[model samples]
Target chain A: MSAPLIELVDIEKHFGPVIALNGVSVSVKEGECHCLLGDNGAGKSTFIKTMSGVHKPTRGTIRVQGAEVTFNSPRDAMEAGIATVYQDLAMIPLMSVTRNFWMGREPEKRFGPFKMFDFHTANKVTLSEMAKMGIHLRSPDQAVGTLSGGERQTVAIARAVYFGAKVLILDEPTSALGVRQTSNVLATIDKVRKKGIGVVFITHNVRHAMAVGDRFTVLNRGKTLGTAARGEIKAEELQDMMAGGQELAALEGSLGGTI
Target chain B: MAEANQAAAPIKDERVREMSPLRKALIRPELGAICGTIVVFLFFLAIARDSGMFAPEGIINWGTVAAQFAIIAVGACLLMIAGEFDLSVGSMIGFSGIVIALMTVQWGFPAWFGILVAFALALAIGALNGFLVIRTGLPSFIVTLAFLYILRGLTIFISITTTRKTIIGGVREASEGDPIAWLFGGKVFNGLFVWLADLGIVDTFVAGPKAGQPVVEGIPMLMIWALALIVFGHLLLTRTKFGNWIFASGGDAQAARYVGVPVNRVKISMFMFSAFCATVFATCQVMEFGSAAADRGLLKEFEAIISVVIGGALLTGGYGSVIGAALGALIFGVVQQGLFFAGVESSLFRVFLGVILLLAVILNTYIRRMITGER
Candidate 1:
């Protein structure tokens, strides 16, 4: 429909003599969930890391809002309205929820010549934001480590959205979560998409990806097999594509059992 | 619509566990130190109260000793919370004192000039320590341990070569009338103490050359420095964004970096601060003693860290409290002097130190487990 919010064209990444990613292209439009499905060691991590500016692609053209850009650092990517919620969630567990919420970008109030962090504003903002994510924290002063995996993910996602991320890249957000947490994360994705933000959902779970994903792109061995719209690809077909039907059968036969 | 409804109607979520206020308070980093201070105070009151340990002069005695520990404890507390250690702090104190003595007494520089030079040199070495740790990715314990020996050796060598002795005197005369030296070595509120003595509010000398003079002169600059540093450290760690960065860097440095925190800068600045505190302690010591000894601050670094640990800082970092560290120092000063007041063997003070440190560590472990929900 409209021009994609962000586009990565012909991305290639090499580590020394090893090619981690080769000629993989993906794009996300406004208010759309683009799922990148891959098995373990399918180059999903390297691809997302490159897209998020942790590593520069050896060859690629990245476009944000139809303008060519190069992100030299994670900060640079953030400046371009691209935020990545990594798998580990990038949270300081021992810190208070409010402190972790406002870690790098703390709000400050000035008194005469001195500036101090605005704890009142920070606490209130954190409460409201966590509430919006359906996480009613008992206190903003509670340590983040005490939160569940699902709640921590919600905090990270809410932080990315609040910071004006136009294209949010989530790396395996539900991989370590329980089934209920997985559904909660999917619901969060649906909510974020409704707010007109582009989402890049990377996961190995085909069913989880298919739950909220509008468009699907399968990555196999550093190359994309194809891209398909929601109804065009069934869950079974996407699952088979991710694991590869022939390879599965071969492994099953070699093992003399179902896997 | 669901999100809007959820935000509009703030229901107490069933999943969100609420902690009792008592449990919450118990998890505070200062809890152990606070409880320990109260217990220690009560114990001493029972045994040493009639012995004049609670009297003005005795209070000042232990207070001064506590101030010594508190000054460096504040620095060590902040640095440890930032996920680093400065084992060289003790040696830095000795090194800084030697530098000041050499510059002022031997090299013919002014006291104020020498003080500034000592601070600059110490801070530079501190920066180098931070740089090496960051660049080599070495554990700070090893790096600073190396510096501890390097600095101690350098101080001794410099002293012996220059003056043919390890101790240098005449600093008091050289620093006489120097405004900066007075800030470190001199007393404050002298008129107030004298007025208190005249009003019979304080004990005064009843005979001899010092008759009518109050036994406790005034609040020494050392006590003031300790108090000021404690306040400054407490506020900085609790009420500032840099404080957040310090916690984040210590908590999970990689996570902090992912969020764009300047972890390296926060750490380096903390190292420099540790050096600054050591230099302050050194300057005050040199002025008070009217001399500088190459081995003056021997084992002071361990004392500072012990106070911080007793204050409930994790050895791995990410959590601590300055007030707690101050209280820990207070306990140290009191027990060290209380032993004498109670007529116990002075060497038993070491036994007390060892026992208290073990107890604090055990308490801290339990508190950490409670907070982290770990077994």
Candidate 2:
């Protein structure tokens, strides 16, 4: 419908002699969820890392808003409005939610000649932003470790959204979550997609991907199998593709079809 | 099902469950240190009250000693919170004092210049310590332990080579009128003490050339430096963005790096701060003693670490308080001096350090469990 907000064309990544991602391509349009489905060792991590600028692809053209760009570091990608909420979440457990929310870009207030972190602004922003994601915080001073797994996810997602991320990359946001937490995260994804922000939801779970993904791209052993629009793919078909069609069929036969 | 209701009305905010205030306070990093300080003060007051331990002059004695520990403990606390250690701190103190003495007394340099040189050299070594750890990906404990021996050997060798002895004197003469030296060695609030002595509010010398002057002269610059460092360290850790970075760097270094925090720089800077603190302590010691000895500050690094641990800092890092560390130092100074005042064996102070450190570690482990919610 509209020009892709960000595009990765023919991306290739190599770790010395081993090729991690081989000529994989994916793109995200505005307000669209592009799900990248891959099983273990499918290079999903390498692809996302390249997209988020943690690793420089050996071959690829990255276009952001129709302009060819290169990111040398995660900071560069963030400056280009690409924020990645990694699997580990990159949050300090012992720190307060407010502190972790404003970790890198802390707001400062000046008193005469001295400057200090503006806790008032930070606390207020943290509480409201978290609430917007349906997480009511008792105190911004509470340690992040005290929050449930689901609430921590909301904090991370809300943080990326609040920081003006045009493209949000979620690395298995639902992988560690229970069913209820996973649904909450899905709802958060729905909210983000509605706000005109492009989302790259990376996961191996076909059902979770099908829940919010508008376009699905299946990555098999560092190469894209195919891209399908919402109605073009079914859950069973995607799950079969994710498990590697023939290989899984062969394993099923060897295991006497118990699987 | 329930998720739909949660999305619709935020029912009761189950996620933000309330805990009792006492349960909350129990998890704080400073709770153990605060309680320890109170217990120590009460114990000393009960036994040493009639022994002049609470007298102003006697208070100054322990207070100055506490300040010494606090100065180094502040640096150690911050460094430990940043997830590193500096075993070289004691050697750095000895080396710094020797450098100042060698430069000012033997080489006939100005006291201010010598102090600057000592600080510069110690910081460089400190930076080197951080660099080696970062580059080698080794634990800071090992890197700094190596530096401990290197710096101690260098200090002794240099002093012996230059002056044929491991001790240097004439620092007081060389630094007599220097303003920078006075900042470390001189007393403050002299006029206030004088006025108080004149008004009979403070005790005065009864029979000496200094009769009518306050027996407690004024607050030593060492104590002021200690207090300043404690306040500065506390504020920097709690009220600044850099403080957050420090906590993140130690808490989860890889996570911090992924989040765009400069973990290497934060850690390296902490090592340098530790060296800076040791140098300050050394300068004050040399100035106060009017000499520098290569054997000075022996085992002081362990003392500083013990103070931080007693203050409730986790050995694994990412959690601590500077005020807590200062209070831990206060407990040390009081117990060390109070032992003598209460007619106990002074050597029992070492026994006290071992006992208190163990007790603090156990208490900290419990608090950590409370915060982390681990069994």
Q: Top DockQ: which candidate number?
A: 1
Q: Write down the RMSD of all candidates, one decimal each.
A: 2.1, 3.1
Reference-based TM-score of each model: 0.96, 0.95
TM-score per model (chain B): 0.96, 0.95
**What docking tier does model 1 reach?**
medium
Q: Mind sharing the TM-score for model 1?
A: 0.96
CA lDDT of B47 in candidate 2? 84
Best by TM-score: 1
Report lDDT (CA) for all predictions.
Answer: 0.90, 0.89
Residue A101 CA displacement from its true place in model 1, Å: 0.7
Off by over 4 Å in 2: A250-259, B1-11, B14-27, B372-375
Error of 2 at B141 (Å): 0.8
Could you give candidate 2's per-residue lDDT for residues B1-375 as a string of tens digits?
Answer: 444343334346554567888777676878788778888888888988999899888899999999999999999999999999999999999999999999999999999999999999988998999999999999999999999999999999999998999999999999989979999989999999889888887899989898777998999999999999998999899998898888888888887887788999999999999999999999999999999999999999998999999998877888888988998999899899889889998888988778877787788778776675445
Q: Which residue pairs in model 1 clash with each other?
A: none
lDDT of 1 at A113: 78
Number of colliding residue pairs in each model: 0, 0
